[model samples]
Target: MDVLSYLATPFTDPLMLVAVALGTLAGVYVGAIPGLTGTMAVSLLVSLTFGWSTNVALAAMIGVYIGAVFGGSRSAILLNIPGAPAAVATGFDGYPLAQKGKAAQALGITTTMSCVGGIFGVLCLAFLTPLVSKISLNFSPVDYFLLGVMGLMMIGALGGGSMVKGLMGACVGVLLGRVGMDNMSGVVRFTFGSTSLMAGVPSVVAMIGLYGFSEALMQLKSRDFTVVKQDVKRIVPQFKEVVKHFWLTLRCSTIGMVVGALPGAGGTVAALLAYDHARRTTKNPEVPFGEGAIEGLVAPESSNNAAVGGAFIPMLTLGVPGDAITAIIMSALIVHGMQPGPLLMQNSKDLFYIVVSLCLIANILLLPFGLTGIRLFAKFVEIPKGRLFPIIVILAVTGAYVTNNLTIHIGWMLLFGFLGYLLKKFKYPASPLVLGIVLGNMLETNMRNGLVAFKGVGGFIGSIFTRPITFILFLVLFYFAVSRMRWWKAMMSKIKGFFKGLFTKKKA
Candidate 1:
């Protein structure tokens, strides 16, 4: 069949249309609940759909994937709890926006931006798959290491008020991340002889503890819970507001797509990087970040959804899984007797187009499904603190414990909850600590691999200059470091003053 026919399949077939819609609706609810991830839902569907026609199975799975990714931000906005790992950065600003009585607005913005990013990614998948896959392939260990370091540098921006305190929080996170056994040397680093510690602290546990449980504990101090009245009429954003953030949405979507294409570096990494990018690049946000910056909500939401589309490129064209969920999808394709490598397009070109068509349909459907219950979802923010805190604590503990089915994980959650509370009490930012935990292993693993590849520290450093991409990344890193320094800021100020004086003289 031709491309037009393939595209029309999902729209024309009644069963296919119903399947996609139902899958998307299921995905949204699954993703909105903490601990019930899209991966789990997709995996379960793979088994149930094993006997179905290829078109029907693919449509359902893609719909769920798209919806679940967008759904994660729902809980992040309503509660401080991230519904999925990718939504962790979303909670940073989303919850604060809820506090300001803009929960509905935040949800609306997220839905709109997510659709834009998803469509952008699908376009890239359709038109630029080969180029993007090639670029994804060229990312060396050194490049990844530099990327992690770049993410770490965002601690300065996320520090809120004190860079020193941010750095300290990051150090603590790094230490906690080191609790797992060493993957390279087979030596247990900080397990301290506990079998549970040998496996390391789960980041999800830490996330729920730090953000959800800690927030609950903090709220316990207050007896009154002021219900913020949400303006349902304002749920859908104005056209002017969309136009204002057009460039930011585009930029973050690009970041999401690129980051998503790299193997194993899924939406979580993409969202974090995009969040930092927005933080550093946006000249003036409408509100301060970590408080309720709309830019903050836009960047991560768009990027993570864009990553979903980017993730499919490598899987369809090269037989490589872009992320864990894509891996499952690829496996399902194999079980259906379709091979997924370079030959996939030659043999099963229709399948490729079908997947693309399903993704497009699903993303478009996401709007109505996502926006329908905004007022109902926003009501979660209005519950009394005395009543809500206990419920949050229960959810937090349950979410943390189910991660590994270990009580020790629950202990870790409580410990981190207390630590997060203390950090907040002392005016330290919790975000950088989470960032450190998320990137610490990636940073360490790549740095070690780069050292091994180059034979020594000096050689590893020199190798970055020899490669085109690595060299460019190094230059970007250098600029990032210098631009944040006091000297550079002062020099730029002087240059601006000199230009102003020159203009004044001309006027005189």
Candidate 2:
């Protein structure tokens, strides 16, 4: 009857404990493979568990949700392929570390940090749900628009030092994303009378082609077929390493939790925001970002896992779901004759706490399950190039097709793959392009909504200054935009040098 008893319920029941453990285990592998998203996995599990007891069904789904989120990092580290959209930022530095024979180290950190973030999120869910949920309800269209712009500005961080090229790549991606019918207006934009294009570009397929298929293509051009042995000697990470990045992990986890609590804004947005924050806040990472920076791994991994807990804040506290996965989960609760929201706490007290405890348990389970696969997962890099490229290409094709069961998607994959290869040849960053597509819809939709609410472009622009949240976001956006400029850096350098010279003369 007490909260402690409810929290301990899962651990007390052997059936529930085993269900959570097995679900976690299955989720890890499912999420590691491209095209098998957590949304799909959780949705499938929900249907199968419709006839099962409520407790076991809830435990199983919760475990899979946590495991899949963490599992996405596995592919990001090993193959430069992010198994889920949330892992997109993870692959930025993960694959680079893998190339340097540190895949094990990367995996270990992601696993441990995921646990830290997961627990932190669950704690927040337990104590701060009311406060967090209230804040989420206050987000206006202008605020969402600003959030999208903030995400887009990460192109500066992702551009590999070429802002112009990054902008160009992002613009191209925005066009690609526009191919589908407009969600608000319901009018087709660029389908060109082709029904297949009606669905627009699939982000997962794009990722598979850009990172996976294109990476394989780029490697083949080198004409080298030798397999390189990755060092698996130090698979387990050191405690000091975890301690060193704990501050960063905590900060990103905070970002994840807050962003996850917002409706329609999920871990993808949270992960990107955390990555940009890490880029700006981390003065001097041991390695530069996009080149195996440990901070890169710590930021996104921790934030995304933390988001899993944050997502529950709204789903349980209000009838509103935070993201697609949470929406499915809310529906599952409905199927069991349990409605979520304010009444959930008073009515289904045991069920609510059981979900919370399972999330905590699943994340803790991430450690052993995550680490055990390192030696085996690292072997991916050791496969001969001649053989590996074909496998990657095959997987990319399969994953792309499996997304919507449409052959045309495979054609789109090849086109994106070609585009990605050309971008690589030109030294342009493919990630900015991907980010453009990922944030394009959110940015466009919110901008349009804000415009309609304000009734004109002038009003929409004016609305930025009319509100506290928008003004703050505008200031942050301006800072990011200006700080990354070459002229700004040059001017700052000159000013600093002049001051240094003046100080030196005075000291003498």
Candidate 3:
């Protein structure tokens, strides 16, 4: 009964409804523009909404979150430019569909499946958040340190093509994250005796620079400004096809949710995994995997959308973010004088329900609004980089200054923006760096606290073997670390070949 009332509040509040609607409407267009991402949009929102009421602020942010994620697919299908990383897989078949004069059909199908996946994720968050929260209540500082370790390992190993490069970027981020006053010792760190450094490097500024400004810089390098025009007809997909893919959509959504729950592996990985699942399971694909298979579209579209819900669970319950956007959201909550974790669940159940309700409403709105602006959005995606990048630069500079109204922060933004551009040029993954920065403080504080509690370094090290939870986390961390080693993968490959040869000999 209590949950029912909490869920009903969003619908009853006219202001909340309008905020969500407007945010989602804006998000759809923003996300369609290449180089703009949900994380970037949310970061900008945090600055603008810092002075607003909590519920209204959250409603607007949540609407943008849902809309931006879905909006990425528009550019992917029409221009072969994935608006965000999560839509990379979508472009594989999406662009092909556009070339085949079925862009409208592809857009409709993706919209439907994205909604299906998103709702499925929300349901999982509702049911699993409490369960995860209960388990997190038992976590000690040692366990948290190990969790941070695992997060870094996963981000490095799975975030990019080169694990070494990913880990290097993450290490740099962790070091940068340490540039503030240490809470435990009351000693300044990495400040170079500058008073301004006492407040440390603002994560908000880093986000604005790295993702927002650097992204604009990266996009400006491409000289091809050609836009392919598509004649979009049939904004609705065939009912029979949707019915036929229903089970596959559910399965992919499940994949997405599970991946999204794990820190560092978000929608991109979920979509890839789901796309691979579809290829392996479909006994007969109407078209081969790469060249416009409708199944390809269904798997990635559904899974990535569903991953959004899964991404929020860890953030709301455990205070660990599932991805960069969630990390920004976590920062927003912190700025609003709220902590997200087990305590958040116990003290602010209403807020939790409100977020869930907003997600549901945004997804419902996604279908109609996403479907309605087909032709206009298709043109919107083609807005030339020449005109677009200047506005983005202006927004980035403004967003940085808004963080604390400090001119120095804008310089911080430019510095990080240049560094981010270098990372992009070298193909280094930016996500691991962001994750490293976010987790560094948590990892250091917990390790120090745990050492003091255990009475010494030896006992702190021993705690991993003594505590059941800590021991399990240690093992998981170990596995993630070892799996990234080239030697281990090679050894596993050899072992597999030996077994296969043995089986063949026996059959002969």
Candidate 4:
């Protein structure tokens, strides 16, 4: 089939249009609800669409995948709870913005940026699939280790009051992450003779407790429950606002697509990396990062959605699933008798274009679906804090329980919730802790692998200098270090003062 035929496949078929629209709508709600991830939704749809035509089935799945990824930011913005792991960074500033009565603005900005990011990813998938795949091949274990270290270094950015407190929280998180059996060795490290502990603490459960449950606990202390009334008129962002952040959007989208194309690194990792990049690179924001900066909202929303497109590059070009959702989608394709390897494009070029076209349609449809539900969804924030807190508590508990269907997980959730409460009470930042949990395994596993490959600590250090990419990453680490140092700031200030004096003398 030609390009026109490939593009028209979804738009021309009545069933395909309905499937895409309905699937996108359902995906938004699925993503807004905790524990109902896009992967789960796609998995269920696979069985339902088993007998359907390949084009129709793919259209629905693509719609859901796009909608669900965008939907996650809604809850993260309106509430402290991140519906999905990818939205965790969104919550850092989104919740703060909501508390200040700009929930509508945050939602609008996130929606617009998410659409932009999704489009960028699709464009990359359509035009640069091979080049992206080649770049993805360069990430060895050492590279991943450096990436995780880079993520961990965000402690300085996220640390609210004191760097020491943030480091402490992150250290605790790393210790918590080490609770399970060693991935390389069979011996358990911190199970303490408990069967449930052997599997380790689930990061999702900890996230719900740290963010959702703890926020509820904090609300319980306050008697006044006045809800912030959202301004319905300003629910959609203006064109100028989108243009102002255009460059940041592009940069974050690139980060999202690149990270997403890497096997095993999904939207969660992509979003975090993008958020850190924004925090580091932005010169001056209207507000501090943790205090509702638009940059924070723009970066994660764009990157995570862009990752949806990046994820397809490997699956279509290399037969490698970029992430879990793509893995499920790949399974659905295989069920329909389509192989997703390098030969996939050569044999079924139309299928490749069809997938790309579906993603485009889904992302376009996302704006209408995501924006229209704001009034109704924003009402949740208007409910009395007492009532809302209980509902949030129920959702948090249910989300934790659903993770493994084990009561022990609930215990862990409550324990972490209380710990989170204590940390918040003491003004310690919780984000770095969550970051530690998320990147802990990646950091540990890769460091060990790098050590083994290079024959020890000294060789591992030397090996980084030998590789170009690793060496570049080392330079980035140095920049981060310099950026955070007081001496660097003082030196820059002196230089600026010297320039000011010289300019004044010249003018006089």
Which pairs clash inside model 2? none
Score each candidate by Cα lDDT. Answer: 0.87, 0.88, 0.78, 0.88
lDDT of 2 by residue, 1-508 (tens): 5999999999788989998998898889889998888888999999899998778888888888888998999988888889999999999999999888888888888888888988888888888988998888877788899998888888888888878888999999888988888999899889889988999998888988899988988989877777667888886678899899999999999999988888888899999999999998898999999899999999999999999899999999888998888899889989988899988888888877888899888988888888877888899878888888898888888888988899998999888988999999999989988888888899899989998988989988998888777788899889889988889989988999999999999999
| Local error of candidate 2 at residue 481 (angstroms) | 1.8
Q: How accurate is candidate 4 locally (lDDT)?
A: 0.88
lDDT of 2 at 45: 98
The alpha-carbon deviation from the true structure for residue 117 of candidate 1, after best TM-score superposition, in angstroms, is 1.0
Q: How would you encode candidate 3's per-residue C-alpha lDDT over 296-316 as one tens digit per residue?
A: 889988999888888888898
Off by over 4 Å in 4: 494-508
Count of clashes in candidate 2: 0
In candidate 2, where is summed lDDT lowest over 10 consecutive residues? Answer: 222-231
Q: In candidate 1, what residue range of length 10 has the lowest lDDT sum?
A: 224-233
- RMSD per model, one decimal: 1.9, 2.3, 7.2, 2.1
Per-residue lDDT of candidate 4, residues 1-508 (tens digit): 4977888888889999899999998998888887677888998899999999998999899989998898888888887888888999999899888888788888889988999999999999999998998877777778888888877777887887577888888889988999989898778998889878998988888888998888888888969888787666688898988999999999999999988898877788889889989987898999999899999999999999999999999999899999989999999999999999889879999999988888888888888888878877777888888888888888888888887788888888889889899898988888878888887888899999999988999988997889998899889878877878889999988999999999999999
Give lDDT for model 2.
0.88
User: Residue-wise lDDT of candidate 1 within 343-419, one digit each (tens)?
Assistant: 88889988888888889888888888988788888887777777778888888888787776888888898899999
Minimum summed lDDT over a 10-residue window in model 3 is located at: 151-160
